[model samples]
Target: MTPSVERVAAAAGAWLDQAQRPMVLGLCGSQGSGKSTLANALKAQLEKDGRRAAILSLDDLYLGRSARAALARGVHPLFATRGVPGTHDAARGIALLDAIRAGQPVILPRFDKARDEPAPQGDEVPGRIDLLIFEGWCVGARAQDDAALACPVNALERDEDPDGIWRGHVNALLAGPYADLFARIDRLALLAAPGFAVVRGWRGQQEDELRARVSRGEAQGTQVMDEAGLDRFVQHYERLTRHILAEMPGCADLVLNLAPDRSLKEKP
Candidate 1:
């Protein structure tokens, strides 16, 4: 429905036409930045021509709370705190991707936010598929060095003393076992909001609405972060996003700026 989203879908569909094999498109953005919506819209474009498209959110690969706790004790404890590279089961995720591309029925993992755990047994199915839409706040957002977090977040710094700390273990995960696989990105589309303040505001409102959904039991184990809480959470993402926000202008194949009314503007 959104023109910006429609543009991204159209671009992706055209790019995949020349692929010798299934193309893996990465939709990267922060939470509430509309990554999933774009993914669905892109799939629609692919399906319109009777082409095959499959979507797999990196969010679904989040490591369980217990595993995260252990990673913190051993790897980076701070990573266990929230979304980051170490938060996902990269091995399983990579294998799943391979399965989907092979066109075998595959059952992906499901993460439960309430219980903070993954389904004991993953979805049972085949591993066959076509275009794999892997999306998330940190989908294609790369890992950053520890020195990157030395500086405080820009918006927070502008407001006052920007003392919030966002450390990255993403660099760790990327350089680790998943390094080679992550490099296979056929294309990456990043949705960049104007500023962290705007991103935080949008995220806060989105979470509040999601909480209402949870209250109504419309969804199970949904994520809910409040204004105060999101402030803290954004600090974590900000440390890692400095590079993303900076590189978005030049790096993303397509960049969309979202208006307050959810209107799309192509970033030139």
Candidate 2:
């Protein structure tokens, strides 16, 4: 395991040690910052130590493509693309957390990014879990101030959402259902990338890996993007990603600062 994985696992292990009931650990990071990687590693470590652990990625909870299309028609065009608040099934996430906490059997949803929708099947946890790692790009994010919403953070916002409707709607969702969902986390950890400037390179690496997986028949999906398409897709996440980086560090229970290359720059 990497140092980040070890560090997070150590923290999560400690959290589980003292918990009176099932615990939820929220892991937040920007796109391609390895939130999923760390969560999987931590889950492995937990199970090795005789704990029942599971991971629920926020990405997998995204509303279906058709749902997002309706959102675009009714709300904003940007909703047609996932990655921001209002794109996920926050109620489902909350219910999963609740069920796990109550020692109930629960089914976990999975999103097939290749097809841009939910997978045909889901992961069913037949029994209660001791720890749940809820990881995502904006898992524990908060809504930005209305004043901050007035300014366009990127070309996507300035040109397409010039009226601020899309971002405003996203912000409202963050302050509402998203807030309630995040509140259930027993502890929150952050994999802090150096800055948003490095996100494209990290995200591009993910796409490259996904493309390779598809070619090898190990994964399914034709949603891979070339440079230009990828750049535009990255724009969909830039605003709130920047916002999370700026604010999450100070408040996150554990913040692991990373270098541009995704290595630890400083210990948590």
* lDDT score for residue 92 of model 1: 80
lDDT of each: 0.70, 0.90
TM-score, cand. 1: 0.84
Q: Candidate 1's residue-wise lDDT over 1-268, tens digit each? A: 5686577767877787777777778787776787888788878877886877777788788888888898777754465665767788888877877766556678877777667778676655454445888887766665556666456555643343334222434566656755655565678787776666677777777888888899999978666876776787776566556567776557767777766545676453
- Candidate 2, residues 39-109, lDDT tens digits: the string is 88899988999999999999989999899999999999999988889899999999999998887889899
Error of 2 at 62 (Å): 1.0
Which runs in model 1 stand beyond 4 Å of their true positions?
120-127, 145-147, 152-168, 219-226
Model 1 scores what on Cα lDDT?
A: 0.70
lDDT of 2 at 166: 97
